[model samples]
Target: MKQPLLTTDFLDRAVDLFADDVGIVAEDGTEYTYGEVGDRVNRLSNALRERGVEKGDRVALLSKNSHYFIETLYATTQLGALFVPLNFRLQPEEYDYLVGDSDPDVFITDAEHAGTVTHLQDEGGVDEWICYDADDAEAGQWDDYEAVLEAASPDQPERPDISEDDDATILYTSGTTGDPKGVVHTHRTQHYHAMVHAHHVEFEDDDVLLWTSPMFHINGWGHIYGLTGIGGKHVIVRDFDPQTVFERIVEHDVSFLGGAPTVLNFLLEHNEEHDVETTGANPVRVETAASPPPKRTIRRTEDELGWRIIHAYGATETGPLITTSNSPRRIQDGDKYDIVNKPGFATINTEVRVVDEDGNDVPCDDETKGEVIARGNQILDRYWNKPEATEEAFTDRVEGWFHTGDIATMDANKMLTIVDRKKDVIISGGENISSIEVQDVLYDHPDVRLAAVIGVPHEKWGETPKALVVPHDGADLTEEEIIEFTRDRLAHYKCPTSVEFREDLPQTSTGKIQKFELREDYWNDDEDRRVN
Candidate 1:
């Protein structure tokens, strides 16, 4: 009596029940009914089929936020082909490795980013090139996206027999070294992950989501399935702007949106200066992840913006949703920010543990820190064509669990607070310091707009903590003043030994700060230099 759990079920259900509803609001403000969207998907799938895309073939897409991105996702997966969406922010030179690895049968590009990968098409091993807005793309034999759909039959494309366990999509994550690792997810993994995500996030047909985050990121944090399946509307935002975010949320009656902590920080800074409207006809709740946000940031979001925070944690390899802090019961008993600020508990159908090097669980005392490992259905099936890397990932400390590489502490309530990344931890004279803890203290300073704490070389303490602060517009900050600010709140050892003021910090396309790039500047090829 059990039906197969497939990602296709999401769009199929939307087309069946909410076919006439405005399902997608495009980047250019065009709206498409679910029926129209499904027709477009069918047509695209038919076109791809004619182009020799079969089951097991890979169809890679390089685009920013757009409605066609969703269409391309469902269309490729509908035919049981693996859909590989490249990070649109990547440089043209970076695609050489990604394209060669995935070896997609067809490569699709948005006109805006088509040129980024156009130079790789011939020698890149991709058989076909399909460009959206072909008129604007670089001149080539690229088939126009709309024309391909227009010429193809609007009838539903013939779907190959697909199993829940079949490989669905390959998401590439920047590896610590070497080439970016392709994390593989199956139909069952994404399908089950979406259902659990929808239940926890409380999505509904009436809910409207603003695409402040890119769809390329773990399939918009897996919302493309959960929200679409629930028949909610998606309003696209290709380029993130605080003013535009406010405009679209109120314009679209957006009830839900997700972004990294850095994104929220930008919005907070923008709202403080411009005092932009925060909400619309519906209440808004933001799902923040990518990196652990400062405690003050969460409190400001709730207090200043009057929006609820749903803090969750995970990575590209672990379904990106194995933990969350949106528990209503815990919220009623606990301090509001205390619960949401930390990655509270393992999500439904997921298991999380903080263990030491010997695989022993750490005490739930909130003071002890250990590496966080997760076991979940949403955990990736494998690393695409990288079996050795996959094996090394799973067997690190625990035998079978997926090692998250995040250092954390589980409270008596079993709510885990991530202290720092395993590598980001600063050890000074044998005492461990959590960089996140120090950063959180800096955020409490009203003049501090943004902050990143990293360990730097020290003559005495082996390696000591340093702070990079981006101050408020006109507020003047001094190193000694910033030093005393942290000393008042945190342990002397954890406080920054030095403070450097900057106008801004480097961030990923999704708004997460690139801490590795910051670290690389301080420590280069000095194995003896790390605070490790």
Candidate 2:
């Protein structure tokens, strides 16, 4: 690790470093230089300050991937306010829970989500909100963000005296126990993650980054700073559509992008009429972690899309980028297919170990699987407002180690393959489904005596949640009614797609539901690494 350079004003320094370079390009063709971005961000910061946004204040942002989202995040940082990015995909009630918990000062949103934000505001107690496209009639009551920026000063404020330990961002992560927990990170920690990513992923100054993933996701795998740290250009996408992604990739000559397995799956399956030129070495390189990419998806990207797909793993609490499956260079000679299939070694700044239940390290023999744990500079500072959870997170007999709760194995050469989430595994589309979350929704059901949800293979949406229910004594419950009940009570993805009536469920001596035993039959023939 190199000696630390600048402590704060990372965006300002990056702006000067890449002044002449294109900093951002919108889908509608608006472009701005790095210098311009810095100026606007500074002005926006001053404007926010005038509007009562103070140091350490939480400012929420609910918008798609666009220049405005970037502007608000950088600007909020300037004022020393924590940027709380809201997932647009989350249900309105979920957002309500988050807002009530975090109590952000102002929510910077776009016209598309104005109605949702308005609804939240009416439920009231929220501080304030500003909309990026308020001039549109659909925006209704929110103040104009553009108007605010125009009235504010472009001069950068004196960098506030912030310690390395001061919170910079509050990223929310869904927990199996409750709504979601805010994973807090400091400036130093986020900088460290970006530094690690830049060195390991090799994001260059000239590279153009296409915003395929939502910015709400761990700051889009830390590309917010990782790419900016190296002076990379950003090409914004308002929403992720297959044709839109391909068009932006070619139109901007995108060299880098990140997404989940679902994003890649959509791109591969898209049979649109656009003439895509994917021959020769692909300009696009993708990093995926939302879910592990299937071997077929990996091969298609490499063979047809000309992409260099890298599988990286991390959680919102880990500053996101922890491990990357760097495609082996030797694959070009022979068995290119096999080399790309392996999830590569631990990341540059991460020290990973596969450990048994007894907390001893497992062998690097590939076949012996254990829980994966990591210690890194990018670990979250704590779970906000929850001291017990924070204490528990940092707790372990091993000093400074954070338990990831993922089961994996390492090869002789240190390549890792993730097997399962310790508690949940679902089998759908011939894929293992980890119901770390479905259990939460099931437990909330009123009539359910005992509910254990698993995944049965599905032709689409990969894995579908299937619940095995033990109803109250002599109670007759139909699968359709249960499915309908869950559909109204939980997120569509979390709802059970199928139901199995059972008199009893398999349980351990200590009374833990044995999900492994329950999933064995559904995943018996699957070749994918996760099912095992």
Q: How does candidate 1 fare on TM-score?
A: 0.97
Write down the TM-score of every candidate. Answer: 0.97, 0.78
Clashes of each: 0, 6
Tens-digit lDDT track of model 2 for 1-532: 6444222445766787887778889768889888888888888888888778888889999887889888888888767789898877655667888888889988888877777767776766656778987876263468788888898888987667666667889988754445578999888778888888777667888888888887877777778887876788888987778887877777677888876654665576563235466432337777767555556667767777878877777778888767877745545654665555565677886888888877888899977867777888888888889888777766653556777778788887677777667655555555444463455455445455566777666678666788988776556789998888878866676678889988887642212355656777686676342233
Query: How do the residues 1-532 of candidate 1 rate in per-residue lDDT, one tens digit apiece?
Result: 9888898999999999999999999988999999999999999999999999999999999988999899999999999999999998888999988988999999999788888887876684788899988999865668999999999998998799999999999999865456799999999999989999898899989999999988998888999999999999999998999999999998988999998888898899889889999999999989998888888889889999988999988999988888889899989998888889887798898999999989999999998889999888999999999999899889999999999889999999989899998888898999999998888889889999889998888889888999999998889899999999999998798999899998899877777666777777788866544323
Model 1: per-residue Cα lDDT at residue 63: 88
Which residue pairs collide in model 1, if any? none
Flag clash pairs in model 2: 325-344, 425-433, 426-432, 426-433, 428-457, 429-458
Candidate 1 deviant stretches above 4 angstroms: 527-532
